[model samples]
Target: MTAICIKCGAKKSFPYNKCGECAFDPQLAREDLVKSVCLSSGRYGSQFEKEKYDDELNSYSAQLRSGLSVEYDQEEIERLDMQLTEVEELDDKPIFKYLLRVFLPGILLLLFLIGVLVVLKWR
Candidate 1:
């Protein structure tokens, strides 16, 4: 039986609501998006690139919300959103930034004081 693919609005012999391009493959697309956004650690080389990525993500989210494509599953979209949030949170933190800023100086000061005390004891 021939039917229309709800995603691309194309007629096909397949019984599924989605065409081959939209055939329950949102996971792959989501993975690509996550990789692009997360792997960069929020360090977009330029403002334009960052805006482009953000626009792409927002468009995908909108498409999922609008149900324009049969492959646009709501549950998957929610999961992707959660993952993006996690990535953003991770990007907000720099490695050892807090430790360096808050503790390194204090530790150095303590070591210096201890060295001075040992020198005085040797006198």
Candidate 2:
């Protein structure tokens, strides 16, 4: 079996991550995969890149089971946790239509009063 090298498109032997021609260590290789994350919008990145990133991570095979620390920020993770906790209430709109209805009458009344005053002054 053969696996394709992601950095340089070349067919290489499997099981052994290091290329015969280019010695690319899997640990160091992961840093390159970080680029797949499109942090611009802080949302999901290119699906194709994300797929490739997952594939490359899986390519290590054994590494997944043992666990690896990609060194994700603890603060950022906590912030995301807080965000997830708040996510449930995100859908619930706080605006009450009654407030607008009440406000509209007051505004209309003020405008009518001003309009009456303006006409009286004009006369």
Candidate 3:
């Protein structure tokens, strides 16, 4: 009987066996999950990048949780949950900070141009 591999969604001979498509083994799911979590938790260039990482982590957690016959370590899943929470917290920066960072340079340039115009007008 063929069953779907939870990690890669590929058809395998059995639910508990190693996946041929992605080489995902139920026996090593915990290690893979930890590795994925560690990889996802890193410095991101922008909010979009962080959000993408968050999505990847979420999908990985879901896949592990939905496995047909695989048993994941509860403590490991809890740790992943904590890491996901941290990632989410990092993603939720105040909009005011982002806006200021993006527009400060333009605002400064506009002020400098206006100052130059005012001085020229006086002359």
Measured by lDDT, the strongest candidate is: 3
**Candidate 3 residue-wise lDDT at 61:** 44
Residue 77 of candidate 1: its Cα lDDT? 50
The lDDT of model 1 is 0.51
The whole-model lDDT of each prediction reads 0.51, 0.45, 0.59
Give model 3's TM-score versus the native structure: 0.28
lDDT for 20 in candidate 3 is 79
Error of 2 at 41 (Å): 15
Give the Å shift of residue 93 in candidate 2: 3.9
Q: Which pairs clash inside model 1?
A: none
Tell how far residue 96 is off in model 1, in angstroms. Answer: 1.4
- Candidates in order: C-alpha RMSD to true structure: 13.8, 15.5, 13.8
RMSD of 3: 13.8
Write the residue-wise lDDT of candidate 2 on 4-66 in tens digits.
Answer: 333433344442255454555433533332221211112224766555544544444334234
The estimated TM-scores of all candidates read 0.28, 0.28, 0.28
Model 1 lDDT, residue 96, Cα: 62
